[model samples]
Each structure stands twice: as C-alpha cells, then as structure tokens.
Target chain A: MHIGRIDESATLGDSWLHQVSPISKLLAFALVLAAVVLSWNVLVIASITLVLTAVAVSARLKGRLAFSLSAYPALFALIFAFSAATSVLGGAVIVLKAVTAALGAVIVILTTPYPYVFAPLQRVVPGIVGDALLMTYRSLFLLIEKFGNLLTAARLRAGLHAGHPVRSARATTRALGGLLLYSFDLSQRSYDIMRMRGYEGRLRVTLPRSAAPLIDAALVGGALLLAATSLLWRVGWRDLNPYSWIVLAVAALGLAAAAASTWPARGRTS
Target chain B: MSHIHIPDGVLPFWLWAAGWAIALVMVGVAGRVAGRSEARRKVPLVGVVAALMIVSMSSEIVPIAYHVNLSVIGGILLGPALAVIAAFIVEAVLAMLGHGGVTVLGLNTMVIGAEMVLGWALFHAILKVIKPTRAGIGAGIATFLTLAVTTTLVVGIVWIGGGGEAAERETGALDPSTLRFENPFEEGLFEFGLFGDGHGDEDEDAEGERYLSVGRFALVVYTLGPVGWLLEALVTAGIIGYVARVRPRMVFEGALAEEMARIPGDETGGH
Candidate 1:
C-alpha cells in the first residue's frame, strides 16, 4: 500500500487470505521476517520471494504488492551496489531478503483490516498499549489529512513553491508544530468522547475467531525451510555436519506438522 | 545531527532485539516517573510527536540524503520516557514503509530516543541556568551533542557488525587517529570526510569498500555531519523559540503554567 494513501478498501476484500485471522497473519509475518534476516543465501531468498508471490496470487491481490515489498530494500541495495561496494552480489542478497521480509508483512497487512489487527492486541498485550495502538491506527488518516492541509497552507505562505530545500523544510517544521498542538486537542476530545460512552481506559474488545494454529505453524515452517535452505546449502550439502542435519530434520518435521495442521478440520471452510 | 539509515538484515538480530527490549522498558519506566498528570499528557502527545518524526524522517535533505530527525525537539517536548515510545512508533511505521528494516526497529528507537533524551535534558538544564531567551542556544548545543553521540553509536554498531577485530587489524596499517578536524573558520563550508593520513588499505574488507572503518567513519561523520548539525541546531533553536512564544507550556512541560497557577497572584499585587 502507498504511504498515506492506504485505502480502507484495500483490506476489505473477501479473498480467503482476507478472511484469515490477523493473529495468524501477524505470526506468519514475524516468522518469515525472522527467517529472511537469519539467512543470507541469494537462492534461498529467491525461493522465499517466489513463495510470497504464490501467496499473493492465491490471495487474488490485483495490485503490484510485490513491487512495494521489494522496492525499499532494492533502492538501498542499488545505492550500495553502484557505490564502491565490496560485493554487489551481497547487495543482491540483501534485496532478496528485504523483499521476502516485506512480502510477509504486506500479505498480513493487505488481508487484515487495521481494526481487526489491533482489536485482539488489547487482550494479548498489557495495559492501554493495545487501545493506544487502536486509537492511533484509527486516527492516523485524519491526522495525516490535517497535517497535509496545514503543510500546503504553510508552504504557500512561505513561498516554498520554489526549490528552496532549507526554506521548505523550515515551513514543514512550523506546520508540524501547529499540527502537533491541534492533534493534542483532537486526542483529548476523542478521549472524552470515549469516556462519555462509559469507557474507563480500555476499549471493550471482541476477540476474532482464533486462527487455526496450523496456518501459523505452516507459515513458520515454510519460513524455517527458507532459512535452512539458504544457510546450509550455500555450497551443497556434501560436507553436512550433525548439527546441520539436526536442523534439517527439525525443519522437515515443522513442515510436516504445518501441512497436517492446514488440513481442513471436519467440514471447516478455509 | 545523526540518524541511522542502515536498512534491515545489516545488523545482527540480538543487537537490534536488545535495543528494542531496552527501549520498551525505558518508555514504561519513563511513563511512571513522569507522574500521573504528565503521563496522561503523554498518552496523546506520543502519537502526534511520532507522526511528526515519521513525516520528517521520511524525506531526505537532497544530495547528502540525511533526513532531519526533529527527534531532539520531540525529546525537548515529550521528555525522555515518552520520547522512547514516540521514537519506537516512528521507527515501526517507517519500517513498514521500508525506509528502514522492521527487525532493526528497536535499535533505531534507542538511537533516536537517546537523541531526544540528551537534547531534552541538556536544554532544560541549560534553561535553569541561563535566560529563557537563550533556550535555543542550549537546544542547538544539545542537538549537536545528540548527533555526535548518535554518530558514534552508529559507527560503533557498524564496526561491530563488520567484525570489529578483523576490520581493526585491516586498518592497523594506517594511523589510529586518522581523522583531521576541518577548521570551520577557513573551510568555506563544512564537509564530512576523513583525511586518513593519505593511506589506503587493499586488505579486502568484509563490509564493502564504500563503507569506511570506524575511525574513518567517525571522521566522515563529523566532517559532513557538522554542516547539517549547524543547520539543524539553528532550526531546532528557531523551533524552540517559536514554540516558547506561542505555548510556553508546550515547550516547558506545563512547568511555567503549573507554577503560575500555583502562585495564583500573578495578575495582582504579587507581581
């Protein structure tokens, strides 16, 4: 999703991926991200990227989510590569892993609405942190709107239409300062409104249906496989040690368990 | 003065995780220490401040690619504890956008939060001793110091990530104190560089040739950083002055307003 322009409708699709629970998606994303970071093998990363593409296809996402996932890392990687880098291939590996990590997160965010993502967090996380996240998530778009309006006004008044970098930055800062004050007032009022509705500190949370552990297990297992393939087979498995073998065994078992778990439970719709 | 731009997977997991864990604990502790009323204020302020940070950090300053952190201002406004929370949120959002990596969120938080804390502490401490009008000078210095520390930390982390010992040995052929400080008086404008005793080592570094050694990196950081550091400090001072004018309470964490309310005779004969 584009920064600041992420439409609510983006997460409102009825694909099976969208129907998946937020918690599961979050877990899957975490695992995949961990795996991507843990391994540095280019081929392994490539395979993970392919897997994510497959997931996107399955989810029926029409937009180019893959590009968004890879673009940030690719930009930086390109910077390093074109510079006096020791290894342009290392940059390639970084891009692949970055794409893998971003894809994992994108899949989760694209499918799950923001509210659903934070709603269950209250039950899981302590204190007002979850509620705070929910409120921030809900209000961010409106706050962004206000910020944009103020920024435009400030830019015009300051004659920032010209390519004056420092001047433009200065105007933006002042606009943000005013926006900061406005946001405080808005936040307090929102708090008051919530209080008037008999809210003490915490929002009443209705937990989404618990995701099948199997889906998360499968995602994590696939992530582990990605990690294993990248780290262990860099030059072929001819000189495999016992420790490596053990890791492979565990990863294989995890994959089996994940496959078993995703199997539809007695007439349960996917 | 300084901010991290290292993308994800560059830093080791344990290091970044530790950063996140420590930052979280600090935020929690900071909230408690701020007292109930101040804590209440922070709950809302954190979001706005985080939004400000995100907006600022998202863009670059052109050729140098350095983004104005504005975190020092955040630290000055939110204090140390809330700054951590706010910094964390900003890093998290940026992580999602891919400017920085998600895994390094905690580490990024700690670095930015430290800037906020250092700036806040330095500014307020100076405010106690100096006139209120000179608060911006204190902010400028605070901004300078914050960037200096952040630069050191960033360089140190990179060194560690690149296998510090090997890199050290590789650079040992050159003088250890290779960074020559450019005299701002003679230099038309400051530039970030390492004079490096005019030595080059072809010892095949692990981290890539484009990146410099810790010592050289420090040289580069200080060389280039100060130009922005000077500009940023001025901007920070300007922001501080403006905020103090419009809303003293916003700048001073309600201290002036609280004191005035407590005195109760400000409009009367007591003045």
Candidate 2:
C-alpha cells in the first residue's frame, strides 16, 4: 500500500511543505479543491495541475511515486471522460481534474503525519468515530504486516498452490479467517492497553505547539490566488488568459528546475 | 467495488451535497444507536474492521480489475450500527489516499454502508432456512445480492449526476441520454474501443459527438459487474464459512444469539 511510503515521506522529509502546519495544509487543500470543482476550463485545471506538480517537486517528493499513486484516479476518470463523449480536449480536462485533485491530496498526506492530519478532524466528528478513525489508521500498518506474514507462511507451507486456483483460494480464505480472529484478539488487547493507560472514551490528540505562520500564510495565500483565478475565469474575466499561459510556463519551468536540483550528483569512480 | 469513482469535480454539486447531507443523517442515527450499546468496547473492533476493509479495498485483483470490498464481512462482524461508522472511516481514508474524491466521501460511505447493512440482514434472513453448516452459501448469496443492489445504486447516482448542463457546456456533449453508435454492425463489435478514440468518432462535430449516455455506462458496468460480484461472493463465503466453523460465536454474536441459543448443544449457541 502507498500508506507506508507516504508515512515515510511525511515523517522523514525536511522540505518547506513538511514544515508547514497540517491544519494549514488542509485548509489549502480545501481551497484548491474548491477551485478544481468550480472551474471547467482545460487551461485552468491544467494550470492548477502544473502548479501542484511544481509544489510537489519543490518539496523534493518523488514525482514517479506521486504520479503512480494518482494514476488510479486517472484510469477511472478516463472511463467517465469517454462516457461523457466530449471533445478530446474535454476528455483530457476530465482526466487532468482527477490527477490534479489526487496530486493535491497526495501532497498534503505525504507531508503530514497521520495523527496530525486526523487531529483536526476529531473536533468535527463524534468522539467514538474520531477515535475509531485514529485507531484504524494506527492499526492498518500492524494488520498489513500481519497479513504479509500470513501470506508468506501460506506460501512456505504450500498452502497456496499457484497451479491450483481452487485450493489456493480456499487456503487464502482460511488464512483471512484466521487473520480476522487475530485482529479481534489484537483489538481486545489494544482496548485493555488503552484502559490501563487511562484512555477514556475519547482520545486526546494535542497538536504540536510549534508554529510556522509565514509558511502557512503563503500556502493559504497561494490557494486563495488559485481559487480566485478559477472563479475569475468562470466569470468572463478573459484578461488573465495571457497570464494563465505565463503561469503554466513558469510552473513547468520551476518543476523542471526543482527536479534537476534534486537529481543525484555524479561521483568520479577511480 | 460498488463505489462511484467519478473524481472530485466531475459530479454535480447538488447531487454530492445531498449525498453528504443524507450520509451525515445516517451516520448520526447509527452513532446514536451504537452509543446506547457497548460502544466503548466495540470501538476497537470497529477500528480493526475498518482497517481490514481498507486493506482489502486497496488491494486489487489485477486480471479482473476488481477490489475485494469485504463490506459484507465487515457488516457481519461489526453489526449494522457500527458498520456504518466503519464505512465512513474507510471512505475518508480512501479519499486521502486518492482512491476516490474527498468530496464524495459521504456518497461512497452510503453505498458501502448499504452493502454492509443489506448483506448482514440477508445473511441472517437466509440462515432461517438453511443450517449453520451452510453459512457459506448464505454469505455468498447475500454478497451477490447486496452487490447487485449497491452496483445499481452507483449507476443511479451516475445517471442523476451525469445530466449536468455544466458538463454539456464544457464538453459540448448533451446531457447523458441513451447509448448509440453510428454503425454498430458495419464497424464490428470488436472494433469498438472502450478507451480509444472516444467511440471511434474522432471527426464527429460537437453537435454530432457520440453520447455514451448512462445506458451505455450501465451496459458496460453490468457486463463487468457480475464477474466481480461472483468472485467477491465466493471469497466472502469461504471466509465466513471458515470463521463460523472455528468461532461460531463471532458469526452468531448479536442478532442470532437468541436463535442459536435455542438450539441446545449447537456450537453456534456460544456455550
């Protein structure tokens, strides 16, 4: 799953995006999402996508990995795009919308810890639901690890025979059943541990006290600018058309520059 | 598998907004119901089940392009009240992971939650006629039927949202209508492209562009859906059957507790 990779990048990165507060990032994401939804112009969406790609690059994120994660949405959107039976440009716009939205999300997730991300959400949702979301996120890594181990053990025990689909499927299902039981036991233990630690009905998640006001403002400002641009374009403001092209070109160039800067330097081999 | 994958901006605002409003209401109702029960104890279980759903949903069976939702299994284990909450969590996490759009979280949750609730109800209903040993068949039947219902739900959602005039204004295609082809027999069935050339009419003017229509979308979905449903049903059946044999109490925990208890010496009685 992309979760592990995303977790690693979020926790280990030292870029500007990594330094930005999670709440700020989320707000920015919301604004960008509003822009994407409001605008139908290909150039506007493409510009937003280009700007996001540049942001991803500036953050030193792996372009291939980010795009790969976004590819699922792109593939599904392709179907709907065709189903819409619009012009080729229209189809491209649909696909771009999906990719751009996915990329925006991937950026936020890749830069913030899961706990930090969910901390804000805990306020809006019910306590039980919020706690469950946190627990689910926490337990996913453990369960995925256990699932991998089970698959490996099944292979070693010859429980999974590639040539025998039926037998393999049966074995897989049984393993999953066992996994469910294990999960139940795990949850019971977790509950006990939480109780021991005095984890009342609600989990208290404290956001870090440290702040990055300037970076946060910049991110939000950039998001607002993007949204304003989209809205203006929708409202017959054609004056920004030439500048949109300039923005796209600059974004593409910035992305290329970021990529080149991050590329590994060649070492002389004696 | 039954979730609508139409990304963030594609769906009509009103449709998704209504979906959110309805989903919130359902979650509120479900939350209240769960709160009256052993919600504190069930919280962890809900988490584990939600995690499992996420794992299954994220893993695709490549050849068929299907993901095992495991929603029915989750429903069976978590029960309907908590299952709805789990569905919300799963959809939220999935959206963050780019599996679907964040805006459609409520709609996706409603679809998957329906599958879970319907599956759980169907399983117990079927158990009335069949022996506990044949629980796999019960689960299989429930999964298939629930999948059919939810898949139809997805089609309905698309049909309603696909009629956006904004889409027409942007794409130059009229609102989604009936499926049509310029010349089906002459072009040959195999010659049609699902992804290429946008229906083999590249040169068609904006007024004449071939509208894929919701009917065609449904045709494609129905064509590909049953295979996924059958596969998921089999997997669910095998898993449930295995669990029922080893831990009958888990399968017959809440709703069937009284019924199974009536059967003296039955392992499902949780004695």
Best candidate, DockQ: 2
- In model 1, which runs have C-alpha deviations exceeding 4 angstroms? A1-4, A7-10, A62-66, A73-85, A115-128, A155-158, A163-170, A204-207, A210-221, A234-270, B1-3, B31-41, B164-224, B254-271
lDDT measured at residue B267 in model 1 versus the true structure, 0 to 100? 22
Best-performing candidate as measured by TM-score: 2
What is candidate 2's lDDT per residue for B1-271, written digit by digit as tens?
Answer: 5577778877767778878888888887887788775566667878989998888887776555578888999998878888898899898888888888888888998999999999999999999999999998999999999999998999888777665444344323221233221221111111232112234543333343332367767877788789999989999999888888877877867422422234433322332
Write model 1 residue lDDT over A1-270, tens digit each, in one string.
Answer: 254334443455765666556767766676667556644444445556666666665555644644554565555444433331234455566556666676666666667766565565345433444455556654567667787788778766874656788788678667766765565565555544665676665566564764465665665676566655644442222232112444444545544554455445423753
Instruction: Tell me the TM-score of each prediction against the true structure.
Output: 0.74, 0.86
Q: lDDT tens string, model 1, B173-199? A: 221244422111111111111112222
> Worst lDDT window (10 residues) for model 1 chain A?
A234-243
- Candidate 2: where is the Cα deviation over 4 Å? A83-87, A237-244, A260-270, B164-212, B254-271
C-alpha-based local distance difference test score of model 1? 0.58
For model 2, residues A9-107, the per-residue Cα lDDT tens digits are: 989988888888888899999999988887666667888888888788778786677888878787777776766533465577678889889989989
Task: Write down the DockQ of candidate 2.
Answer: 0.39
Cα lDDT, model 1, residue B23? 62
